[model samples]
Target: MTTFTLEPQDNGRLQSLCGAFDEHLKLIEKEFNLNISRNNFTFTIKSNEENPKSHHEKLIQCAIKLIQDLYMETAPIKGKAKELELQNVHMALQERRMLSQVEPERAKSDVYSSVIKTKRGVIKPRGVNQVQYLHNILTHDISFGIGPAGTGKTFLAVAAAVEALERQEIRRVLLTRPAVEAGEKLGFLPGDLGQKIEPYLRPLYDALFEMLGFERVQKLMERNVIEIAPLAYMRGRTLNDSFIILDESQNTTVEQM
Candidate 1:
């Protein structure tokens, strides 16, 4: 239901706005699979979705921003209100909507590179809270990653481990978790070591696989550079120089903790 009208202006300015938004609009269209209808400077969108309403408005705003940027480069312009075609605007918004859905996996791929790259600041600097806690771990040799998930505490720890190994600071990497059953009674399960432990440790394996590419992770496993095993096996072992990750700490009893 939104509308836009390009007012009378120098043909040069109109041409510049049109040219800039045209390709950008096309990219949006191809990515979002949307059709655009335009005449002179006017534009509109037609879509089958009920929520095409707000997306229509957003597309207009995006095209206007593109035009504003283009105009600033061509001829310095002060504050000027620009009207954008609804169809053109919708195209950009639809592309953006698609991008958001895949960003997390893309971010993980980027993080894997960051660890391998080992450039300064490749491992992002921790915030004040994380830095303070990490500093305590360095000073005290023990720290807890309490609080909710998605806070980057565990992931950052994994990153630090990778960084240390890449720097030759650690001889090996170790990861383990208590064999706590999710809900099914342990007695009812019918598998050996691999089957019983795998269910509880799959998350740790997934994190490792994400941080380290599959081939390298497999190579490390073969060379004993990386080890994922049951917590019981850790008993009576003296770890000299290694990176260790204890996942699912909440499931651990006081004796295990």
Candidate 2:
């Protein structure tokens, strides 16, 4: 059995860590395949196995670390401890998966420093890759985010672009993606070049519209401040003082790129 007591325990912080009816603790128990029991701020952890495996120590350590991390999060930010949610617990656990690979100090700094506030609310990176990706975009003039879908590659880029435009660091924002079909063939599709390509660039536009609002995004597009650059039409364009985003650039041919 592994046991530990949370230090300098405050009722609110302990409550936040364990969650309502100890749901957070239950989640940890489920995730780590362990049984957890608590008496006040003190907790015990034991493997569910009839006999603990050799690697059970490592497993217990990971569980303890997660609990400690969650407890740290419960520290009062303004005056009240940040309430623990299931989602927050999941993200904290996911983000720490890279703890061995990434330097903790740097990752923590990058995450807090690159917070992106939009029309919706403040946006923070979920994991290590995202933290590093945002840091790269903020630091480098020409930065590329290569990641799988739903990894916030385009979302973070749009956030950075909107922030730059809002700060007057860039004149305008230009969004583009190679109009390559993933499953559906393009020739069979209806409408003009713009109409057809709009579907390809919809993700970029959605991110923009979410951050800037529909009316504001439309006004910007109308004034040519925010442009959707089809791969074919971008050959002769002289873009200066702009935040140009080339989403799905991998689909572009070498000549087009």
Candidate 3:
């Protein structure tokens, strides 16, 4: 166990540092397997093992450094302290290479240990590689899940997106794919943007409907909270605060990419 004090901490800064219900601190603790209790500016980090391994010590130091870095980032902005979001905390840790290098091998023994929670249920990785893939989705801004068909790659990706949306981590979910017709030649289709391209993006829709239910999905689509569009529709607009999925990327040309 060790104690560290963030110097000259202000109350507002502390709130931003800890996040809502100390969620940010909780994330750090989970990542490093440490218990953090705080008194104003002072914090105590307690590990489960009394005498932690050398790598564990290194992780502790890394956690402390990350806390210090995040604290530094909480400095007042134009006379007001900026609120630090979960994504901000994640970005800070990723910048330090903490998430990538610190996840231990033994963490994967339970395939369901690191799971994505959705309203429907928990999504578990089927194998070691899938476990790493889920972790990548967690710790990276964008991830590509490449695998053979029926390997849960597409389903898991959609599950993660649904979980993110349900958690309010993102404002919207936008799914897109190339619309190269395989066998059918439909001369004309009359409908909204999403309806026109529904066939091409049906797989993505199926996953969303399963997670969010049919009526809710329809309501979200009406509100533009969930969008289904062809890849060509993405050219002129910027997507922010949204989980965007580009499915069937193999069919895209260099220009489309």
Clash pairs, model 2 backbone = none
Model 1, residue pairs in steric clash? 59-89, 59-90, 60-89
Error of 1 at 118 (Å): 4.2
Put down candidate 1 lDDT per residue, 215-245, tens digits, no spaces.
8889999998989887767878889898888
| TM-score of every candidate | 0.48, 0.64, 0.54
Q: Of the candidates numbered 2 and 3, which has the greater TM-score value?
A: 2
Clashing pairs in 3: none
Instruction: Give the lowest summed-lDDT range of ten residues in model 2.
Output: 104-113
The lDDT values for all models are 0.58, 0.80, 0.76
Error of 2 at 250 (Å): 1.2
Q: Give the TM-score comparing model 1 with the true structure, all chains together.
A: 0.48
- Name the runs in model 3 displaced over 4 angstroms: 1-112, 181-196
In lDDT terms, which candidate is top?
2
Q: Which regions of candidate 1 deviate over 4 angstroms?
A: 1-121, 125-128, 131-140, 182-187
Q: In candidate 3, what are the lDDT values of residues 1-257, reduced to their tens digit? A: 78899977688888889999999999999878888899989999878787787777777777887787677667665467767899988766554443344356554244324567665544556555676677777778989878776777777778888888988999998888876554544347677655666776778888988777899899999999998888888898888889888887776889988
